[model samples]
Target: MNDIDDFAQAYVLHRRPFRETSALVALWVENLGLVRAVIKGVAGQSKSAILRNAWLQPFQLIRVQIRGTRDLKTIYKFEPVPTGVVIKGEPLFACTYINELLLFTLNKHEPELHFFSYYQEFLKRITDIFRPDTEIEPALRQKQMIIELRCFEQYLLEAIGYSFDWGSARDENIEVNMAYGFEPGEGFFPQASGLYQGALLIAIAQGQWQTKGALGAARAALRQQLEWVLGRSLHAPSSQGKLMRPENG
Candidate 1:
């Protein structure tokens, strides 16, 4: 948006130190889909700098006043907003997984407003997973995370115009008992021996998360389709451990 002054809520999708006094930030906002911004004096001991530093972090809801007409903008004001989102350990990698996907897949400077709610829902589920009172087993927690990330991956694909047609396979009515394989532009076609079973695919498509084979099939299909869209291996942000295993595809 080419406004002399613009104010909106934003989350830092990705960022790095830029030069001596500024940070190069990639932001996702409701009004401006994706933006790369420069915010200065973040490291200073001054109160404003500290506020900017705290507010301009991933998963925190920060209100900013920015001004620019181009792809890269400048943030001139930071409105304080208290945040309780703390993502760390294994969960941090999952958080970064979706954040990186957003940075890479979304078009810069366009408003995908619905993504704001989509992202917030994701962060809510993530926060619940790490909440101390939840008392979930490690194995079950991992399964919950797999379902959330795969669903988010599907949202990203839909936003980018690669959404799947759940009801049909290769232009024919999808048979729930059959197996199918995904092709880049050709959609899904039935396979006598396929990596994806129609029932599992339907469960995921309908937002129902199940155990064992269903999760496995969902993960495999998403991995293959997402990697195909990116045209490379979808590497999780560097970790000593592996996250979800979508190896069936």
Candidate 2:
């Protein structure tokens, strides 16, 4: 059966050069999942080429028409969708990180409509917390980024059939002054010298985006789980996942 979408909302996850005038585009379609398509005639300063370059920008929401019988489809049409979700700085890098995550985890042609909405929500929240200038403190901004990332990772893992639970320590509720360790199959358990403390865990469970210690702890736990889930890591996760510009970026 040939999967098709005549008109759909999509976002550009990643784009790289292909041939001369065309490029390979990876789109997260609204009703469909990940779709890799050939976008033709996007080179030079032609009027049409200028439009496609502006519209197909990374993380920009857009409308598209993709059609093909096999795994690789060709983009027949696409246009940008305007929105207030303007992302920059750490949040922008976070967007790339999640884009990489979807590329690694999502299978082509599978319908994950809800996940698409989840992603839109993620961007909105990032936009909400992100300050364009130095209005927010560095520590606070990093903590917020960490919180958003943990939540995003948790949902992604659940969607892929893995659970990285931080709700509690096994059956007992998380206490503010205690330590806890994590097990892959089971959940959290009490450990006097565990990596994360209950104060941090409680803040995490409560969605405390600005709590000290919680940011690093939450990041450490989810990153470990994410690495295990992927069986590896992405391009410089530690640096790419932060506000500081990565060397390559």
Best by TM-score: 1
Clashing pairs in 1: none
What's the lDDT for candidate 1?
A: 0.72
Where does candidate 1 stray beyond 4 Å? 4-6, 44-48, 108-111, 135-138, 236-249
Worst 10 residues of 2 by lDDT: 240-249
Q: Compared with the true structure, what per-residue lDDT tens digits does model 1 show for residues 55-158?
A: 77788878888888888898877665565566777677678767766666654323256878788878888888877777887667877877788788777778
What TM-score does candidate 2 get on C-alpha atoms?
Answer: 0.82
Q: Spell out the clash pairs found in candidate 2.
A: none
In model 1, what lDDT does residue 151 have? 81
lDDT of each: 0.72, 0.73
Model 2 RMSD in Å is 4.0
Model 1, residue 205: what's the lDDT? 63
